[model samples]
Target: MSRTSVPPRRARTALLAAGALVLAGLGAVSVMQSPASAAGLQCSVGYSVNDWGGGFTANVSVTNAGTTAIDGWALTYAYSGNQTLTSGWSANWTQSGKNVTVTNLDWNKTLAPGGSTSFGGNFNYSGTNTAPTAFAVNGTPCNGGTSTGSPTPTPTDSTSPSPSPSTSTPPATGDLVDNPYVGAGVYVDPEWSAKAAAEPSGTKISNQPTAVWLDRIAAINGANGSMGLRAHLDEAVKQAAGKPLVVQLVIYDLPGRDCSALASNGELGPTDIDRYEHEYIDPIATILSDPAYKDLRIVNTIEPDSLPNLVTNVSPRPTATPACDVMKANGNYVTGVGYALAHLGGVGNVYNYLDAGHHGWIGWDDNFAPTAQLMHQAATTSGATVDDVQGVIANTANYGATTEPYFTIDDTVNGTSVRQSKWVDWNRYVDEQTYAQAFRTAMVTAGFNSSVGALIDTSRNGWGGANRPTGPAAKTTLDGYVDGSRTDRRFHLGNWCNQSGAGIGERPKAAPAVGIDAYVWVKPPGQSDGASSAIANDEGKGFDRMCDPTYTGNVRNGNSMSGALPNAPLAGHWFSAQFQELLKNAYPAL
Candidate 1:
């Protein structure tokens, strides 16, 4: 559940004249439009396209020019050449014949004066792909021409005001837009590709799902340009061509990472906070901020397993080490996270989600409030507002079921009376959905914008029929029978490293719940959490007793189970056996 590797690491248009051109070619053509005159409103549209041989990607921006605001608006346009719509984002796109219309989603319906919103579409094209010519907003033409309507009269101030200096303050509400950058494409890691290719055809791991992880060890080692952060990015961009590149980067490598567990030990020491900022964070930020990557939509999960430990396991847990105290005393966790939030958060297209750990870690009352306060303070210290972050991510690299079928946290089962046990306390009784919603409410109450969304790591929380019980057993006892009967229970809450009997959870989806933004595979399915024991390797990960099947779980580490996983590889490395198991036991029978 912790990482320690390190390495590596836009639009448009104008009234066709004053706006800048972003990309030019068959691959992408983007133009920004200047203000056009409409009687009651002045509006402009910026258009951009990403072309890939038979198909292309297009994004359009609608800007309001006049001083008055509109509650709703619709855009209408027609393709000039042989182009057909495939899919679109941020708006509802529909076509009849050659014309296409885009309407706003519920969240993005309102626009303030001088405000703008962007939508993108993927299209199929033939030999020639020409930009659309005519565009209209709410029936008003945006062809760099004036509209016919009676203009609103300007009002004059009655009283003279004394001259004084004005100070700019942050907006009362943060940006309400969901992760604006969109495309279905995910950046496939070259290493993962190689691994998959090496496997024989028809093998389970030959087509396993994989993701890219940026940890502390890789960053520190890769900073000097020897190991290739830029190279990986360049390759991903090339593979994406003109398509949207969805890259997942874990901004880990804090000084005292994994304070509660030693399996995923990081290379960086607690006192080396400055090195983390310069050698680690700054270089990665520079690579991502590079102009060549303006089209790539980066999803950064900042400091998984780092922040929540500062709340729950830092002080009270006996298994916690001095590293936690050092992190707290020197403000390493907050400052490092804040640095990441400010530096990467400023990137125009990057969507940063600070890790809120799993529901098991922060779902309790004692841990929830403090975690929110920590996140708020981190944002402030980093010189970034809550607006800079997209939202909070829970269950980043943990195995927690998305839902529990038989039980609810309300202490009732099928309308029958049921008593909640101490182990299944109010906090522990919830699933990822309930946990995320409650956490979102708590975070917004702690001063985050109401628009802030939630994300869950559904990579491996699917407990399929094999592990689940056939029928409800006696609920009389809390120890052996209750734990055995519960379908959603984990072998041990603290056992995170290469958990046994785990299955691939829900597939990636967007807006799965009320406050949730997306159900993402933050942790790649096949990658090992850590090795069974310390083995000398270039990956810079160490061994822990937790991954060994022989090592009985203990109360000190909060792992009170019998069996630990056996034969797992180092953290972030490919484990073919584990991959096969995941595929065989996949939830929804993937």
Candidate 2:
């Protein structure tokens, strides 16, 4: 339920030039038609981007300046560089070399004069990513010149922004359109890849990207004999091959980390906040800010299970532990986390996503709002503002379905609300996606930017296999229906170790859901969450009973039997059995 990891391309937009358009930094670079030319075309386009080295997401608003409704439109433009189209929303996008064309979707064909509609696409490129110089609307060879006020004009009564909010997929964050994952490839760790590939039929997901956990200070320089931070970045550079790529790093190792659980305790003690800031965070920041690795989009999943503990695992909550109480009293959790956010966030190419505990932990209304406030507090203190943090991540290193397709929180059976069911426990969310999206609103309400997005760790949350429910359960007792229909099959909602029946979740992908930046495999699938039995190591992980299959319940897990698999290795170590189980039970099935 807590503790784990965290982990744009602009391939999306070419506002064809025929009129005035808004390009954020370019300052009112509009797409305008000459007055003396054919009266057939008179409109404006707004182009904005979130670029990370080799790719970008282009968002454009095309406005009809003519008095009459301009029906059936297509916007055309040519990229000055070798930009290739990746994916787009609200338009039928096509590209040939530098020339790109975006035709309005059937739902968006009518461009009412004085009204504006927007569409965007993701793109990949090499060398300079120069803006397009020419644009034509609907076969009119019109001259596009600059004349614009704010980039986005107010939509008039007739302007239908194609792709209704209800009917179409939500788009990426525009204010921070420079999302690093949009058109970039994720950095695939050779270490994890080799282990996965060694398994039977493992090649299917071995090549996928996963985050590297720098759980200890030694990990920064390469713990044991593994790859160091710079070494990984160096390899990421090679893998980038002239295009933008992302390297995911978990900035863990805070003083008294994972206070509620024993499994992920860290090297620092409760009051060792100074060492955490200078020794751990500062060193990593120094390396990431180096210009050599600036081209790689470095994503830091700023300490999971840190600030959230101050809310759910401290005084007043039944789940509170003595360790959590100690850390809260000292206030070092906030200090360490705030320091990490400020230093790591200072790197221009780096995007820091603070970890929000999964829905199971904070979905209750009482816990939800306060958790967001704590996150904002951590972000603002220690020289960090909300802007310093890009967004948040949920279900890190934990199993929470990206969605529960079979049912929703609103479901009821025999006049009983699903929230009343024991499985739901009156919690507001039924799955990670709902909780994450709603938490995004909460974060903004708590004063983070409206542009702040969310990331869901889909690494082991798929919950698919033969036991996976095909549809909603038959109408019966509310508990029966909710339990039978749920995609997450945990014996109890609170279980959070190397759970049996867990499968690899959605493959790592970019800009997946509304308010979500990406679905990532931050906790590599095969890595054990903790030792099944008491084991000792120098990395600072402990053996929590939650990882013991034979152990009985805890207050956090409703006193149920621990559902973890037996004989698992230490946390963060590879467990072949776990990996194979994930492969076999994969939801979209391997």
Best by lDDT: 2
Off by over 4 Å in 1: 1-177, 180-183, 197-210, 217-227, 316-319, 413-419, 426-428, 470-485, 538-540, 556-559
On the 0 to 100 scale, the lDDT of residue 298 in model 2 is: 83
Candidate 1 positional error at 232, Å: 3.4
Over 1-590, each residue of candidate 2 has an lDDT whose tens digit, in order, gives: 21112222121222232333333342333333443224566765555454545666666556777788988888787776788887665567898877788898655688776676666676888997766645567755434443222223323233332221111112222323346688889999999999999999889999999999999987876778898787788889999998989999999998989988888888899887756655566557656755567677888898988888889887877788899999889988887788787667656567889899999988999889999999998888876777777788999999988899999998889888899999999999999999998998898899987777788999898888888999989987888899889999999889999999989899988887777789999999899999999897888888899999999988889999989999999999999999988998887777
CA shift at 587, candidate 2, in angstroms? 1.0
TM-score of each: 0.65, 0.71
lDDT of each structure? 0.65, 0.77
* Candidate 2 residue spans exceeding 4 A from truth: 1-177
Best by TM-score: 2
Tens-place lDDT per residue, model 1, 1-590, is: 11112111111112121222233341222234446666686777766554446765565667777788867889888876778886565577899888889987764588788777765566787877766656778877774654223222222232522110000011112222354323446666666656656654314433333445678644522433433556667776897799866677788788877776776778888776765665466556545654557667677888888877777666665545677767877898888888777667656656778888767667777888889988988877745677667778888888877876655565444443333454455464457888887787778788876666778888888866487765556555544344655555466566677777787788777667777777877787778888886778755467778777777787643456534467877887778776666666677666
